[model samples]
Target: MVQKPTLAAVTHQPLARWIAYLNAVITFKTPQGMRLTNQDLTHQGHTVRATICHVGPEPADGTMLYLHGGAFMIGDLRMYRHLVARLGQAARQRAYFLHYDRAPEYPFPAALDQATTAYLALCTDPAAGPISLVGDSAGGNLVFALLHRICTRDLPRPAAVAAMSPVVDLRMRAKSLTTNRRTDHLVPTSWARRGCTAYMGSADPMNPEVSPVLGQFDGAPPCLIQADETEMLADDSRAMAAALQAQGVQVDLQMSKGLIHVWHLNVGRSPEADASVAEIGRFLRGVTSRETV
Candidate 1:
């Protein structure tokens, strides 16, 4: 594995500070032509809130369920409003972004349950078409685990999945975890390990649901993973891709250099971010392989 040289990327603000800032950032109106609805859904007795964003004319067929990344701590539907809006735009459909529970208060199966219920709800919705699951960082972990669980528990799997800089391996044992430690501005090695420990509670770190690297995935949905050359979880995506392919899952992997984890949030400031989004848009187009809405 060739390590890319690190860049002085901008450090993400602390969770609280960033959340406060986000509250004031989107006050300005969005594109008038686009319409996005925001709300919540009841899943397994949990009121999992979600923001529904629409991109095209109206009545979108397929839907992509989005899970935001926050190291299993911060981040929610409101925090990722802009990104969800873009996903709606990218797919020319509506996106339902899940605001699942975070760690400490509600960890492990809590988010998993929310994801499962969300998918089930979508499958029942009238507008449902070929569905997809998308997530970043810990959310990526949920996406992978969701697929495995859906298969194991006989739930419906999505048409495909696209994960960006996902932390599939919660044990923090990926080779890139050590090699890219100094390069990734999004996650420090200590922080990654610490987050894993907190999220796991008493559960085993390698429990496929807790950390998907150990999970069995056969006949899994087609998967596309995007990672950065410098992110600690670069190997997380790589290892999952190799495993998914070995199991005969259609897989597409792209690694962008000198970027941090889930750099898609940098869509406005960094060319790398836009490039990642473009590739994602292309990947979605290919996976769906259907006509426009």
Candidate 2:
């Protein structure tokens, strides 16, 4: 069997090159047979890029808004096409892969604001049907941060939400950051901190919008969190689950052993990745069904 390249192996290169490398690999590895279309979402005069992915002839009744993870500094819609399509196919929904602006250049509120804009636009469109949110790594942070924003703004909430290997605590207080440092092949503490710094810019890291673990999730919808037990961000998921439960939100935290961060990216090739996506699809479908009922 050909050995798969670890994220750490390629991330050492320059940002642009690394992103190109991953995109090339993902494009080649993604399973064929999904219809994809580009659609731009505009709200309050701001436009956000989004790609819609679906399978079969008829459109599904709901939307799954996917936020890709690249530590908030990298990642794009192309790299996530496979995962989004598979999840959408699993849940019987048309998935929208959001291409939010990156940090260091765009910074803090840019991505958040764009995400909020896309979500609100989706909420208002009757054709969007019931909407659910799914994000990974930095995107996971957005999922929760967006939830906080929705709750505070008194906006319509998503029917369900899922975060995979999310970086919820920007405080870097999670013990797993040290404990699983060597075990996690995808993210290093120093690299994660750098990404956080780039995304935060002048913002305080502890601000709930920056580090969603610190945010209040009152009235948030049911959430499903999945993380690698041995990855550095494990505690982020654990802590967020506790916090959400305390806030009276229904939370399901699933921890997998011996997997790298955001392993769902390997959906077509890895059994574990396929299983994780399937599980999330089921959770989303179930919750969204209840929401519409």
TM-score of every prediction relative to native: 0.86, 0.93
lDDT of 1 by residue, 25-78 (tens): 653234345555767666556566677866546534467899878777666654
Task: List ranges where model 2 is wrong by over 4 Å.
Answer: 1-14, 17-28
Which residue pairs show collisions in model 1?
none
RMSD of each: 4.9, 2.5
Q: lDDT winner among the candidates?
A: 2
* Predicted model with the maximum TM-score: 2
Clashing pairs in 2: none
On the 0 to 100 scale, the lDDT of residue 104 in model 1 is 61
Q: Candidate 2 residues 25-133, lDDT tens each?
A: 7443565777789999887787888999766545455898998888888786667888888989888888899988887788998998989999988988888888998
The 10-residue segment with the lowest total lDDT in model 2: 1-10
